[model samples]
Target: MDIKLWQAIIYIVLALIIGAAAGFFIARAWFKNYLKKNPPVNERMIREMMRQMGRTPSEKQVRQVMSSMNQVK
Candidate 1:
């Protein structure tokens, strides 16, 4: 193979690597932001969890749990 062909191959490989890394980070950041804005667990889910644990959650209890969870974010 010619020297030019080798150089072209190296450049293409480098570009692919850089693109993959950048895309990975961007996708990860977007997912994190999406989850933050739309939390996976809501009031109903929390109530269900408490019920599973054998306790019926009250409005105050649910609100407290929500506040604590949001504070962590």
Candidate 2:
């Protein structure tokens, strides 16, 4: 390959690597911020939701629901 071609190829590869790394970090940060703003379903929310549905949730049921939700994640 010509010297200039090799240099161009090297620059492109470096840019791709840097872009990929930057994209990964940006996406990771966005996801964390989204989670902080929206949050996830928790045991207290589940219990409240169940209560609103006119069913009293037991401790064991709440724990089971929380475990199931965690497993999906």
| lDDT for each candidate structure | 0.96, 0.96
Native-to-model Cα distance after best TM-score fit, residue 68 in candidate 2, in Å:
2.6
For every candidate in turn, the CA RMSD to the true structure comes to 5.4, 1.6
Worst 10 residues of 1 by lDDT: 36-45
What's the true lDDT of residue 24 in model 2? 100
Residue pairs clashing in model 1 are none
Best by TM-score: 2
Give each model's clash number.
Answer: 0, 0
Model 2, 1-73: lDDT tens digits are 6999999999999999999999999999999999999988888899999999999999999999999888988
Q: How would you encode candidate 1's per-residue C-alpha lDDT over 1-73 as one tens digit per residue?
A: 6999999999999999999999999999999999999978899999999999999999999999999999999
Model 2 — TM-score against the truth? 0.86
TM-score of each: 0.57, 0.86
Candidate 2: C-alpha RMSD after superposition: 1.6
